[model samples]
Target chain A: MYVNATLVAQLVVFFILAWFTMKFVWPPIVKALDERATKIAEGLAAAERGKQSLELASKRSAETVREGKEKVVELLVQAEKQSQQIIEEAKAQARIEADKVIAGAKAEIEQEAARAREALRERVADLAIAGAEKILRREVDAKAHADLLAQIKQDL
Target chain B: MATTGHEAAAHVPSAGDYIVHHLGHLNTTGHPQASVVDFSVINLDTLFFSVAMGVIGLLLMWVVARRVTSGVPGRAQAAVEILLEMVAGQARSIIHSEESRKFVAPLALTVFVWVFLMNSMDFLPVDLLPMLWQGATGNEHAYLRVVPTADLNGTLGMSIGVLLLCFWYNIKIKGMGGWVHELFTAPFGNHPALYLPNFLMQMIEFLAKTVSHGMRLFGNMYAGELLFMLIALMGMGFSSMSGVGGSLMWAGHVVAGTFWALFHILIVVLQAFIFMMLTLVYIGQAHEGH
Candidate 1:
């Protein structure tokens, strides 16, 4: 209850304590708080950047996939056209080979018919000469009938 | 003073004498101070407890400061940060100058923690420390008042320290000439006849702020301490009473003691806050014009 020299002593102690706190306690804690706030802000910004990059990558992949699908469709169409052209060329080549074979067969048939007719005419002429020799007496007119036999052969 | 049971009962101090004895402080003179105001005597108990509380409180803060992290804070670190934020917030709102806040904020924090610790001393059982002191010193009539804030000198000592800071800030912010001029011209006018009245009013304002600042904390803590003493006196009455009344006195003692102690918890923290706020306000006023 009394005010004595203790008041003065306490006043001195008070200043000392306040000074000690100012020197040792206050700054570090406040600095930590500020630093923590900065760190949280930076972390949030980084997270946002990561999210944006992820979105961009997804979009790019989707575009590439679409491009790949179109390329596949184009290749399929080109292959189908090439296959149709190859089938048409093969049909034309087959038709030409068939016509050549038919013409060669017709030529062979004509040659064979001519050879057979010649053999028949020669045989007929020989038979007529034998008959004439039997009908007339032996050696008469052989030279005179030569021209007629030749003409008959030519006609056949 | 060592005596058998019968002699001990006879030697026991009366209720009034017991309270008066507890009120006595351990001072330089080795006796209760007789004078109402004496500059020569020092209350060693008040100084010792106040310094002890100050040292302990600051050491805790220092330890937390040493290990503080910008990352997730430990519980102790978080608690200290909360207290610092509250003090710093008040300081920021009241004191406009960033440069001045460097010192003033810490000063407010120191005042809050130190006063709160000193006020918490009231929670100790009234006779606990004194009895221990008597046992250690082997003095049957040893004096020890634990709550430093209960002593007018201790509270006034701190309030006066705040006053000195106010003076420093006034001079620092408003230069010596400007402060002196304001001291005379403020809350009145620039007129020459108003100077004397303005000066008088300024002095009274200073005096009133300082006294009320110190007296508020002192009065609350002192009254709380006295009420504890009175509650303890009821226990003495219980011992001296017979069957029914004795039991009733005992119940009253326990009930009153518990209720008062619980209520005093609020007062203890509130008084600390008021002291800190007033400190910021007064220093802030010093930064402003009249």
Candidate 2:
């Protein structure tokens, strides 16, 4: 088994096979591997992004709930303050109405008292004139007692 | 003993004749009596079997290529992918040039598959192919060797191809001048007097590497082939006696042949891998500066 033309033939076949493999076979297989790697990496990245977004959304929802609770607390306090102010206004109004009614009743009583006193004073003047006429016997000089009557009236 | 067609018609051959007959090749030139190192004689059997194995290797790669997918792979696809990854790993570690690997990696892959196929032919019964060849040609002396790697010419041919690749890369990577200068000054001082010695040493190293690379594979496979023949001869010896002893010999042949074949599977794959690795190493070294 010595070397001869077969070696040349083998060399030719080796080169052909090597060249064919390099040109046709290797590229596609390597490309498939690389593509699969990139796809897996991209999937992982997307999953990471989705997880982050979910966390953010949960945090945002929690903040909204807290803000809603705070707003409800503030509204309840404001409503309570408004109700107190209304109660205070109603109490002050009732007090002022009572005071006005009392003042009207006092003015009416004073007018009525003044009227009664004037009537009593007229009646006393009349009765005193009649008694003086009776005591003086006759109508003697009733016209002449005008100045006395006036003074009596003044005294009454 | 397992005899060729003509010997089968005649009396049994001596052990030497049997071994010599098994070692003969179907040559394209030169007589069977010619010297072992006859350059004009081409071993037709080695050429035929190697080329056939090479085609089979190419077909296997081609089928995998055509059917390969990016998704989850089937068993065949997975097997090919694993093989490819293994070759790529070796090439990456040895050959530093990413560009050269485009060629070198596939070259190594082809070499491994082809040599492994050739080496695997040793598993077949040693007389099977030759007997068939003798029968087909109607000639008792038809010389047919089944395992191509068992032949020195086949292994040396491949190693010489690797050597040429090494030389090509040497020139391509380090210019011709750089390679020549390195040959004269490598692994020693750069004195004018040492140039001849350095160059001679470098040549010897190349020669030694190529020769050993080829001889290692040839020796292993040749020994294996011879062992199979001897085992077959033992079975033949027992069969000629025609008794319980003959039956025992048949059993022994089967047992021994099976054990050896089982062990040889490792050699088949290992030799292929070693040859591929050396190819990568030599080619890689060519790309490196002294």
Candidate 3:
């Protein structure tokens, strides 16, 4: 219960402990805490930047897909138009070839018909001459008949 | 109490004597103190226990401080960091100057940990250390008090340290002339007629703060230590028992001691916190004008 010199000794000890703590203990711990705070902030900022770039890349990829789809559709339309033109040109060429073959066949048929009519006329003249010889076999004067025959033939 | 060993034929101490002996300090004089306010004597028990506790507490903090990291912390590092941040936050709120807090915050942390460790000595069996001391010294009546904060001298010693810091900060923040002027003139008025009253009030305020700060911790610890002794005496009642009353006394002692020790955990932490807060508050006031 007494106030004694121990108070003074304790006071000196107290100051020594406090001075030691102030010099050694407090600074490094506080520095670590502040540094951790800064690191977390920087990490968060980097994540935000990464997220934005990812969004931009996705948008660019989607735009490329849309362009590719449009080009495919345009190419298909052009191919379809060229195929239709080729089919039309082939049909016109076939029609011209058929008309030329028909004209050549018609000319050959007319020449064959004229030759057949001439052979028929020669055959009629030979038959008529033979019938006249049979009839003149019973006649009296041969020299006189010769002149008549020649004149008849001319008239025929 | 049952007296065993060589003291069986000797006279036994009364309950009052038992408590008085437990309260005695193993000082340089090697005897009980004669006066209530003697500055000439020093208490060796209080000095040894306080410095030892201070050293142990600081050593723990220093180990953690050496390996402290900005990345993920281990259990020991996290525990120390939590304590450090709590003290730093409190100092930040009370003391506005960052430069002052560099010293003041760590000081508060040291006070808190040191005082808490000292107060925790009450949890040991009241006679364990004293009995051990007696055995080792071959003096059956050796005196030893383990808890330093229970002694008024130790508490006042630390409170006076805080007071000195207050005075130093008062002069540093407000120059010597300004602080002296404020002490004599500001509380009432600047007039010469009010000077004496203002100065006296300022002195009284400083004295009151220091005494209460020290007394608060000392009184609580002393009362707790005494209660533990009383409980121990109750347990001792059964050692010499012959009837049912002795059995009841032993049972009561167990229940009361257990309950008190459990509740004392809260008191121990709260008293340390109050002392630290008051120390910071007083020192912070020194940095202000009024």
The best candidate by lDDT is 1
Question: Model 1: clashing residue pairs?
Answer: none
The digit string of per-residue lDDT tens for model 1 on B14-110 reads 7778888988999999998888999999999999999999999999999999999999999999999999999999999999999999999999999
**DockQ for candidate 1, C-alpha atoms:** 0.75
Residue-by-residue lDDT tens digits, candidate 2, A1-156: 455666666667778777777776777777766777788899899999999999999999999999999999999999999999999999999999999999999999999998898788878988988887788766746579878877887789
Worst 10 residues of 1 chain A by lDDT: A133-142
How does residue A33 of candidate 3 score in lDDT? Answer: 83
Q: Write the per-residue lDDT of candidate 3 for residues A1-156, one digit (tens) a residue.
A: 877899999999999999989988888888888888899999999999999999999999999999999999999998899899898889888888887888778877777776676565545544555665667665435477667655654555
Q: Which stretches of candidate 3 lie over 4 Å from their true place?
A: A85-156, B1-9
TM-score of 3: 0.85
Interface root-mean-square deviation, candidate 3: 1.0
lDDT for B38 (candidate 1): 94
Task: Give the worst 10-residue stretch by lDDT in candidate 3 chain A.
Answer: A120-129
The TM-score values for the models, in the order shown, are: 0.89, 0.82, 0.85
What are the candidates' interface root-mean-square deviations?
A: 0.7, 2.0, 1.0
Q: Write the per-residue lDDT of candidate 3 for residues B51-162, one digit (tens) a residue.
A: 9999999999899889988998889988989998999999999999998998999999999999999999988888888888888999988889999999998899999999
Among all windows of 10 consecutive residues in model 2 chain B, the one with the lowest summed lDDT is B29-38
